[model samples]
Target: MTAVVSNSTEYLLGQSLSSRDDDNHNIYTNLLYLDTSSPGFNDPITFPKDPKERENLLELPGNRKVLIAQPAVVTDVGDNIRHYTLDCHGFQYVNHTTKCSKEMFLDETMIKASYYPEVDQLIKDVTGASYVHLFDYAARGPLNGDDGDPKINRPVKSVHCDQSYEGAKRVVMSRLPDKAFAEEVVENRRFQIMNIWRPLEPIYKDPFAVTDARSIPDSDLVALPVIAGDYTEESWAAEPNSAHRWYFKFAQKPDEVLMFKCFDLVRKRMSPVEYFMLRLRTGLKSICPHDKALRSELVWFTVNSSSNQIHDRYL
Candidate 1:
């Protein structure tokens, strides 16, 4: 753990007025639902992968109306995962079992790492997960200041949860395919959208911030429609509430992973960017704030375990 640098973006929890161009660079505090009938939506969203595109990545044409605000208390969170998120649900952090090799990120042998089994074993050791699936692996870089390069994915600075209830159900159905198996899995197994997120290098500027789910009531979550590539997914946007609590372990390192729940079976269960560093009121910060790029790798998959066991022996 090196010295961590801290920064803040004024996120917009309420709706004012924004434009399509501000989508990637700006995060809206208000919940903006999807209007798929809008023009060019059916058209392929292909474009030159340039600075402008990355900055406005979240932008889409749609009809959205602002909703009422919710009430709550806001608290600053500590770096301990077990205290804030794991036992609390929604998110958790843990130390890696071994040293990190940067080469694994670039090889892209479909993410064929020698220690992959070891990694899964580590995940099982912590979560008591019987089936740990590695579905996707991606590398994200940090906010690219003038010196920032576009080739790398940036460390997301936006405050948002990745999945909605509908999206989770859709994923389960697509993965399982068999109605009987899917139903049985959904009925008997514990499902979680878990991500093993860690920086490939040391993080100081713009460390990841995860809001405590317990602090947020269901009313504050808005289901916003997001269209990327060929798919449209519904994602939850946290409407800025004064009571929303935010936590982060500053200067996050390569040997540590943020195992977070984008959506879990427990509301019953549920589910960045800078201005290219701020645009929204509750998540606002700057247009560009870095002179270099940040490297990070996140491998996420849903795990199903018939039994819930805590493997704290190694810890």
Candidate 2:
């Protein structure tokens, strides 16, 4: 994707990337990429399960910053972005309006009761899956020290995919009550682990960006270990590549939904890893005069076309 550079000005951290013409189609920003210069850098970095320990390692010097030019996503091209399927581009955008109230996002009980069903139906509609199970959801906000809510987490800054194929299988087994059924599904049934992301309010900072899966090669993927208590899981992180093409919806609204595939059992030709990174790109400086934080929410759904009755133990 080629971007028309309207201005030659350089951008620093926390600065605006918009041009003077107010181009809504592209933004230049810095994104974190894995640093492969260190010896044995591909070796898994163990992240402690404890939040305090994890926070200490958040700013580890293992990552390198790269200036990335992400084009604004054009939703009106053809079929309302349906051409960019999970199988093709690893991500899709849909103009879906939700019935859940904003207050429902604040409480876990309300989120499970109201928002979960909404997400389930949305996933079923988009994927045409016989069954859609929402496993987890996270409400993320800016890195404010005094939020006081444990449910709200700081937005992730690095370029990474959520799960690896083996990690996804473990998640399936952990969520299913019947061990036999879980094994069967993992071995035979084709499934996908997808993330549905939406902004709770209009996005002005920290815009979410995803790279076209076709642009990424398998050689760039590096498996990183995540230690959670007694269990450990692997996720994919990528080294910087010049061929990568990034896209994001400028000033994404609450009604817009970005659905991306994290792991797809059927699309084995292309790697199941879906690559994405979020950057703190300040929107049009004139409109966003005040530097307020941004808030968004994401839900993970396990989708399958199976009609079999398997008991699910939601985690």
Candidate 3:
């Protein structure tokens, strides 16, 4: 019998946020719950009974249906972990935002100038990428949880305290703040930023990959091949003569596992200017310190840049 393989996002939803088992049994530290009014939800679908057959893509869990069901409703997410449910039709904005911020080690600031270098160094330590992508914002209300054209997920500003670095304040939005006369017009921008605006569609493609298969049952190794196809083929795309490719040198070992860590720079979604700005942040030596109020403004500025860039390409 084939064991059921869960998507990363779904697996993450099921994780017990406090379990401290071995690497094979660690639990998440957070939980995400969806409001009952969400159109993107439905009864949980059980896995196939077969033990040997790999799960089909459609049969695997996702949030597609939740959005389809409540195309234009406000999605409410509670902070408590026990109330969280992994069973749903489509992914929720609250879920994605919570996950991304957590993954990036970001608080509300999204771009905490003080911790910018530390964030980069951490990523560099792990990924060995000297540079990391960062953005600043003034205010991110739209993405936070504002309701709008039911169909639109406006960007929302998250808040985080800058540790010790000094820089600009709040993120800014170029256009008018969401005029949410009604829930439909509230605009789900935060969802767009967290869910969309990514080089990859549904950035949470397998939100549960690291937490679930790896930390859950020991049987995930058998399911790796199943989850492998869930990722875009572009993840493995190689272009010769391209500046994006990173060649690695590996030492031969009798039985050691040689892991090749490479960044697949395909599907770049940033504008050249945005890319340059990202590069500039790493080299900037002159730093400007701002209070929470001012930092809030800077956050808005970065959000405006992100929104403008996303609109240029998508809207």
TM-score of each: 0.64, 0.73, 0.20
Q: Where is model 2 poorest over a 10-residue stretch in terms of lDDT?
A: 281-290
**Per lDDT, what order, best first?**
2, 1, 3
Candidate 3 residues lying further than 4 Å off, grouped into runs, are 1-111, 136-263, 266-315
Candidate 1 lDDT by residue in tens digits, 185-248:
4554556655566666655444555555666666656565655444556656545555555445
Candidate 3 lowest-lDDT run of ten: 280-289
- Please list the C-alpha lDDT of all candidates, in the order they appear: 0.46, 0.55, 0.19
Q: List, in order, the clash count of every candidate structure.
A: 30, 1, 80
Say which candidate scores most in TM-score: 2
Q: In model 1, where do residues sit more than 4 Å from their true spots? A: 1-82, 98-100, 145-151, 176-180, 266-299, 302-314
The local lDDT score (0 to 100) that residue 58 gets in candidate 2 is 39
| True-structure lDDT of candidate 1 | 0.46
User: Please, what are the lDDT tens digits per residue for candidate 2 over residues 78-190?
Assistant: 22344555556767777777787666676888888888888777777667687676777777655332355566765555567766656777777876677997787677566
Q: Report how far off residue 276 is in candidate 1 (Å).
A: 43
TM-score of 2: 0.73
lDDT of 2 at 33: 55
